[model samples]
Target chain A: MTLYSFIFYILAAVILLSTGWAITRRNLVHAVIYLVISFFGSAMLFYLMGAPLLAALEVIIYAGAIMILFLFIIMMLRVEGIEERLFPLKQWLPAMGLGFISFQVCIFLLISAGSEEPLKAAMAEPAIFGHFLFRQHWLSIEIVSMLLLIALIGVLHLGMEKKRKESGE
Target chain B: MIVPYSHVIFLAGILFLMGMFCTVTRRNLMMMVLGLEIMLNAAAIAFIGAALRHGHMDGHAMVIFIIAVAAAEVSIGLALIVCIYRKTGTIDAGCIEGDVCEL
Candidate 1:
C-alpha cells in the first residue's frame, strides 16, 4: 500500500457513499447535494489520474455550472419542497434485479479487460493529450457541440409550447 | 495502509452501482435526475482511475468529453423538468407519466 493508493481509496469511498446517498434519499434537494459531493469525489479522482486540467474542468463544468443549473430549475419549478410518493415496489423490484445483473456483468468485463495489457503507457507530457484531441477527435468535439445546440433548441421549443398553452393559444 | 489503482476501480464500481440503484428506485423525477448525474460521474471516476493506472492522457481527455456531455445533459434535462412541472404541477414520476408532456 502506498500513499497514492490510500488517498485514492479514501476518495473512492467518498464517491461511492455519496452516490448511494444521492440515490436513496427521498428529498430531491438532498439528492442533489449528495450528487455534488459525488462530483467532488470524482474530481479528486481525476486529479489523482495526473490530469489536473480535467479535474478542474470536472469541478467547474459538472459540479459548478451544470449542478447549479439543475438546482436552479428545481427551485424555480418549486419541486424541491414538494412531497413525493414512496417508491413503487412493483415496478422497481424487477428493474433493480435487472440492473444488478447487468452491473455485475459490466464489472466482470472490466476486470477481464484490466487483466490485459493496460492501454497506452503513461506519457510524460500532458500536452500530447490536447494535441490528440484536436487532431484526431475534432469531429467528436464538433458533434458534442452540435448535440448541445439541438438540446438547447429542444428546451426552447418546450418552453414556448408551455407558454402557448398557458396563454391559451 | 494505502490502496492501489485497482482499489480505486473497485470503489468506483461500487459508486456506480449505488448510482444505478438510485436511478432504478427513486420515484421523484428530480431525484432520478440526480441519480443519473451520479452514475455519469461514477463513470468519469472510472475513466480517471484507468488513466492513472495506465499513466496516459487519453483517459483524461475522455473525462473532459464526458463532463461536457454531462453539462449538456443536465441543462436540457432541467429545462424539460421545468416544462414538466408547469404542466403537471408535480415532479413525481407518476404525475408525468400520462401528462401531455411525456419526458
Candidate 2:
C-alpha cells in the first residue's frame, strides 16, 4: 500500500515476467537478456531489503561481470543455429508437481513468519551486523577470497588448454 | 507501518517459481544456466530480506559471497559449454548425451 510496497510489487512482477521469458524464449541471446533483467530486479529487491551494498554488488558482479562472461562464451561457442526439440511434457510432470507443492509451502511459511512479532523485535541496531561480519566472520571472508583465487586459476588453466588444443589442430 | 520485508519474500518466491519453471522446461544448455542464475538470484533476495527483517547486514555480506560463487560457476560452466560446442558443433542438451564425439 505504501511507496516501498508498491515499488516492491513492481520489481517482483518484472523479475517473474523476465524469468519466464528467459526460459521460454527460443533465442539464446534473448534468454540471456531476460536473465539480465531478472538480475536487475533482484538487485532492486536487495536495495529494498536495506542492503545497498549487496544491491550494488549484485548489479555490478552478477548483472555486469558474470553476464558479460556468459555472453562472451555464448558468442565464442556460436551455437545459435543448432536445431533442438523441445523437452517432452511428460519429463517435467513430476518436477512441476514438486515445484508447485514446495512453492505453496514456501509462501505459507513466509506469510506466517511475517505475521509474527519477532521480526519487529529483530530490527535492532543494523551496525551490529557489520561488526559481526568484519570481526567475528573475518576468517570466512578470507576463505571466500581464496576460493575466488582458485576459481580464477581454474579459468586460466581451461583457457590455456583450449588455446593449446586449437593451435594443435 | 510499511512491511517492505514481506514484499521482499513474496517477490523472492515468485522469482524462485519462475526459475523452477525455466529449469524444468528448457532444453537448451545456455537457457538452463540462465535459469540457474535466476534461482541463485532468488535465494540472494531471500537472504537480503531476512537480513533486513533482522536489522542485520550479515545477509548482505553473505550475498556478496553468493555473487562470487555465481561468477565462478558461470565462468567454469560457460568454459565447459564452449569446449562441448567445439567438439559437437551444438549446444542442445539432447545431442551431447550418450556418446563422446571428437571436436
Candidate 3:
C-alpha cells in the first residue's frame, strides 16, 4: 500500500477505536475526551483525503469549539459522577444485532457493487472553495447563519428562564 | 491508485454503525447527543470521500453546512437537555420516558 493509503487505514482505526471508547465510557467527561481524539483522527483523514480546508475546519469547529462546548456543559452540570445503567440487555441486544446485520449487508454490497476504481487525490484549495461556496450557496450560508443566531437566542432564553424561575421560587 | 473508493465508504459505514449503536443503547441524554454528533461526523466523512472521488467542491461545501447545522443542533439540544435536567433532576431517558422524573 502507498503511504497515503497506509495513513488512511491507521487514521480510520484510530477513529473507530476512540469512538467506541467514547460511547462506552461511563463518565461524560472521559467520553467527550475520547470523542475529541476521534475527531482529531477524522481531521487527519480529511487532510489525507485532499480536503485541507475541511481538515482545518474539522479541527477548529469540531475538536476545538464543539467538544469544548460539550466539556463546558458537562462540567457545568456536575454530572460527571452520575451513575448510569448502560447497555441494558433489552436495548443492547436488539441494537447490536441490527447494527451487526446492517454493517455486514453494507460491506457485502460495497464489495459486490460497481466501481472498484481507486479515488484520485485532489485537493480543494481554500480560496476556490470559498468562492464556490459563496457563489453557489450564498443563500444557504445566510440561512445557516440565521439558524445559528436562533440557536444562540434560544440558549440564552433557556438559561434566563431557569434563572428567573430560581428567583421566583 | 491510493485506495479504492469503497474503503472510504466502508470507513464511513463503520463509523455510522457505531454512532447508531451508541444512540440506540445509551441511556443518558448527553450520550445520545454525542451519538448524533458521531453520526453527523460519519456523514461528513462520507461526503468528503465523495468529493474526493468525484473531484468536485460541492461535497466540501455540504460538509461546511453540516458543521453549521451540527453546531446549531448541539447548542439547542444541549440547552434542552439542561432544562430537562433542571426540571427533572435526572438525565436518564428511562426516567423521562416514564414521566416519573422527580425534582
Candidate 4:
C-alpha cells in the first residue's frame, strides 16, 4: 500500500522472476548472468531492509566476485552454446515438489514466529556492524578466517594434483 | 509500517526455493554451484531482514561471515569442478551415472 511496500514487492518480483528464469535457462553463461541480476535485486532488498552494509556486501561478494567465479569456471569447462537443454517433465518433478514443500514450511514458520505487524525498519550502519563483528562476534571472525585459509589450501592442492596427473600421463 | 517483516521472509523463501529448483534440475555442474550461491544469498537476505526487525547489528555480522564463507566455498568448488572436467572430459553431472562411461 505504501511506497516502501510497493518497492519491496517490485524487488521481490524481480528476484523471483529472474532466478526462476536463470534456473530454467539451458545456457550456463546466460543463467549466471540472470542470477547476477537476481543477486542485484536481493542486494537492493537488503538496502531497503536497513542493512546498507549488508547490501554493499551482497553486491560486492555475491553479484560481483562469486558470479565472476562462475563465469570463469563455465569458460574453463567450455560448455558454451549448449542452448536450451530443457529438463524433461520427469526431471522437473523433484525440484518442483521440493520447492513447493519448502515454501509452505517457510510460510508456516513466519506465521508461527509471531509479529504479524510490519517491522519498523532499523539500519545497522557499517560502523556499528564492524564494532559488533570485532567485539561481540570476534570468535566467529577468527573461525571464518581459518576456514578461508583452509579452503585456499585445499583448492591449491586440487589444482596441483591435476597438473601432476597430466605430467605423469 | 512500510512493509511487513513477514513480506521479507516470504520473499527470501521464494528466492531460496528458486535456488533449490535450479540445483535439482540443472544438468551442468557449474550451474548447480551457481544455484548453491543463490541459496546462500537468500539466507543472507533473511538474516539481514531479521536484524532489521530486531534492531541488532548481529545480522550484518552474520552476512559478512556468510559472504566470506561463500567466497571460500565457490573457489574450492570450482577448482574441484576443473579437476572433474580434466578427468572426465565433461561437465554434465549425469555423465558419471550413465554406466556406459567408465569412471
lDDT of 3 by residue, B1-103 (tens): 5678888888898899889878977788899999999999999999999998888889999999999999999999899999988887777877775566432
Please name the candidate that would achieve the greatest TM-score relative to the true structure: 3
lDDT of 2 by residue, A1-169 (tens): 6676667678878888887777777788788888889889878766665666667778899889988887887777776765545556677777778878887887787777666542232332346556767897798888888888888898788768868988999
> Residue by residue across A1-169, what tens digits does model 4's lDDT show?
7788888889989998999888888877888899889999988988888888778878888899889988877776788543335567776777677767887898897778666777776677688778777999899999999999999999999999978877899
What value does the lDDT take at residue B9 in candidate 2? 70
* lDDT, model 1, position A32: 74
Q: Clash pairs of candidate 2?
A: none
Q: Measured by TM-score, how close is model 2 to the native structure?
A: 0.85
Q: Sort by lDDT, best first: what order?
A: 3, 4, 2, 1
Candidates in order, interface RMSD in Å: 4.1, 3.3, 1.5, 2.3
Q: Write the per-residue lDDT of candidate 4 for residues B45-94, one digit (tens) a residue.
A: 88988887888877788888889989999999899889888877777776
Identify the superior model by TM-score, candidate 2 or candidate 3: 3
**Model 2 chain B poorest ten-residue lDDT run:** B94-103
What candidate 1 gets wrong by more than 4 Å, as runs, is A80-126, B1-5, B98-103
Please give the lDDT score at residue B41 for candidate 2: 87
* lDDT (Cα, 0-100) at B78 in candidate 2: 81
- Indicate the worst ten consecutive residues by lDDT in candidate 2 chain A: A117-126
State the C-alpha RMSD over the true interface residues for candidate 3, after superposing those residues. Answer: 1.5
Question: What TM-score, to 2 decimal places, does chain A of model 2 have?
Answer: 0.80
